[model samples]
Target: MSVTAGMESGPPIGVTAGPASDRGEIHNWTDLFYFFNHSLPECHVELSESTKRVALFVLYLAIFVVGLVENLLVICVNWRGSGRAGLLRLYVLNMAIADLGIVLSLPVWMLEVTLDYTWLWGSFSCRFTHYFYFANMYSSIFFLVCLSIDRYVTLTSASPSWQRHQHRVRRAVCAGVWVLAATIPLPEVVHIQLMESPEPMCLFLPPFETYSTWAMAVTLSTTILGFLLPFPLITVFNVLTAWRLKRAGRPESRRHCLLVCAYIAVFVVCWLPYHVSLLLLSLHGTHIYLHCYLTHLLYFFYDVVDCFSMLHCVLNPIFYNFLSPNFRDRLLSAVVHYLPKAQPRAGRRASSSSSSTQHSIIITKEGTELTAAGPHHPSLHFQAPNPSPISAPGSLTAS
Candidate 1:
């Protein structure tokens, strides 16, 4: 979500154009500018500019290709069987779409980094690119939170009233999430501009009169809304979900519970470093007397972690869809459907075996019957007596 380009030689707004000698004495207004520009010449000793550019180009390219392919596969596979739509499927589809949005923006970002943070595109692109990236980033996080909450809710409560309105409620929640995600990036659209400083670059430059205050506000707000607030909610809900699954005393409950915990672990590993860097940058912007070396080090740290955060776009599909047994079955069915001749013998054997096997039924708290084909298929495939939807196995659902 932090799409701003690396700083060049330009003096950002609100910073006085002073001699190199004054660079040693940092002020609040100049701190952000210096932070981006890496005012200390010694910092260049860590990695040469050419090396950094090549490394970033490689990273962005890899993320773009892998994330694009993974999310597209998720969307394509899930898009089928619309008649069997369920809340978990809807969440997976939406989350894949969000991750795809983030992946699509990577090429432009790749080009920007390759050009040494130059913005060859004009003003409209500058705003739209940042807005699109941030919106999807937030939406992806929100959808994960939704997935967590849905897992916990379905596990603990089975009120007739709640079950009756569950689909409608989930639809409304998805719409609200999309709207909130779009709204959160409006400040970026306003503040981000194509600045033709030392070189043309897309940068977030607030008004000069309120530069420091605005910068700090934006940093803190993004950290809070994007990570701080949502992460705790995700952790709590997933933890409770895992706990409930463990108490269920089913054979597959342990594996299912660990998968649930993975949701929290992956989110934290991918996002925590980036938010910590943002907090450090925010602290530096407060004129909190950091040594010159430390300030430069922070800048480098931020750049690394910012790119590192993008691993979520790639990992989301693996965790949310590919890991689910039902989704895998669906994907295989889809593949075989399209390529009928590819595995005819195996398909026949599988179909015969599945049809002949006796299904074991597990009753939920609401007394809904879940039919499992055999021991090989650990998930209890939901078969509601009513029209309520059923979720894919291993998708935050206990078997």
Candidate 2:
């Protein structure tokens, strides 16, 4: 009776007593269907309690380790690198910080899952634990949006006037993003409290009508802003960037294409099912009566999809930042600095180190510099058979 006629767990609807509980069992061969509406088979849930504990423990433990190490590595490199801080670097740093929030907060939920969904932590812990879960999710999303906007600005409006004010504008936008993202979890934090079903569970709001209202409000806001708002903007901006690149006779790098494609795919694929289930549960404020089996199926789907959504935090850096050579170089440099064999060398050792580093589409005659070709920071290159003639041997700046 997790969700009863007067209680709401997630769905903003009242659930009637299940058929197994509502009717008497037939001992002998009886009517094929005791009730016409109850003829459908019961929605089966086969995962045992022990199995769930093991699965969740493994999943959360793995995500925590990978996400922690990767995000920390990213933050360390960008902050301590010799390269001057750029708009892109700043965005990546902020995103990494937000992701750390998610990774650090996962342990509380994992502990609860391990205990068979019991809330050993008291009322205060219940609200606090859930708050970080949502805060980081929204923070990561908006930071990604800011990165896209910065890239678009860099490519199209690199004039002198824009350059004068660009740094200040970027700083302000970053602050605003943090403020808004932090504010999103306040409503939930205020209302969430501990509830006991003999095992003690953390329920967001009270049961029945109030619970339904609260759930609908939270899910609708999350779906509308988190997915609907940012998704369209990301798509439109990327499309326009691509079209502009094509018209200018510049082919996008495979790595850049893969990064953007992965971002869009993961954002949509992981989140769509969760929102769809919420919509079904919240149809007409839970006024509509859906079949019992269908409700079970939707709830199950929602739970499974949620696990996938958590994985986005773990993979974001790998797809977007780790693929960049500049990023990797910076990360390696930062890491080596603390090692025993990190000392600088002269003569043969320095020459050997220099020889090992190589970049395609580059010709060094004197000064060598690298700049972002697009949002991705791809190597500056042109498709001409002899591109060297256009920029000479020393300079290779992409237009």
Candidate 3:
């Protein structure tokens, strides 16, 4: 094809040197080479030669599925447990909601990625999409911090004080958390803009003049505020709780401590890489294309971390179903209820025999003999029935 045809066809060129019969002229080396050497310069920006859309779609879809299913399961399993509707549960539910909100924005992000980072959605979407993204992220952080504080309060405060203020505190904290979350994304709404890319089909925009730098700063600050700040507090509280529970010798307390520790560990593991990447990105910018490349790499990696962050949602359900004895028993009963009947064991029937010997109620009381003839027969038990019951083992009973 001719040079013009080559440009139109998009890529590749072939040149031939021979007599030009049509033009009735000689096709020399210079003329032949000139035919292929067009004036068009190669476009500086290039989209991936591969189908980026398909890959991005699959990845984002998986993220949505995993995050949604895990969060839903957590809510479902813990919704009715004793811990359900408690401070911890409330914080977790909020976190799940935040994750869902962020995940909701994935399809939009996928479009941007697929279209080579061009945003086809108008100026309004360009501005608001970021709002959805950061609001949920900040909200998730606030809820996590709330959870840590809840653990701390439950562990350190006097029971009477905690009982009086726990619910009120939780409500106030959650409300403030939401307010903070909503405010963090306002800059995003105000700053985003749309621009043209080399590919007219692609939409591209520069982040507001200083927004990239500002975003990097805010992201780093938020990482510390959201993840690093809460980690130590949560870790210390959980450790103290575990220590206290262990000393108290309560099996349930130990299990609760372990679960909290597991949560702390998971949160750290999942978020640490993302934070590190963010820090690196902040240190560099698009001025270094490597930074831009790393940013894209970190972007996808962060998405994976985002998916795992919602693993916290799955945790509450497991905690309710497995950590609490009563809840576990109920879960087991539910399972057994749905199970098929088991065949009787091939063995001798259990003997129904009973014998009783009377004993003195007190050292001063006279001893006597009593007999029982059947398994179901009532025997003389020594403890007297109390007229009142106490809330705890050592407390005075209420009449």
Model 2 per-residue lDDT at 277: 65
TM-score of each: 0.79, 0.74, 0.58
Off by over 4 Å in 3: 1-56, 76-87, 198-213, 252-258, 285-399
Q: lDDT winner among the candidates?
A: 1
Q: Clashes per prediction? A: 0, 0, 1
lDDT of candidate 2 over 1-399, digit per residue (tens): 011111122212222122444445532111212332343334554534456456767887888899899888877876774246344566677778888888887787577656655677787877666676677778788887776666666666647777677667867877998889878878756765565643466654434325545656666787787788878876666555544545565454443445456667767775676666656656532467567667655544433445556677777777656755556555665555665543333334463465333333322233323444432100000000000000111111111
Between candidates 1 and 3, name the one with more favorable TM-score.
Answer: 1
Question: All models: lDDT?
Answer: 0.63, 0.55, 0.45
lDDT of 3 at 320: 28
- Residue 107, model 3, lDDT: 73
Residue 18 of model 3 has an lDDT of: 19
The residue pairs found clashing in candidate 1 are none
RMSD of model 1, in Å? 10.9
For residue 240, what is the lDDT in candidate 3?
Answer: 59
**Shift in Å, residue 26, candidate 2:** 30
Per TM-score, the best of the predicted structures is 1
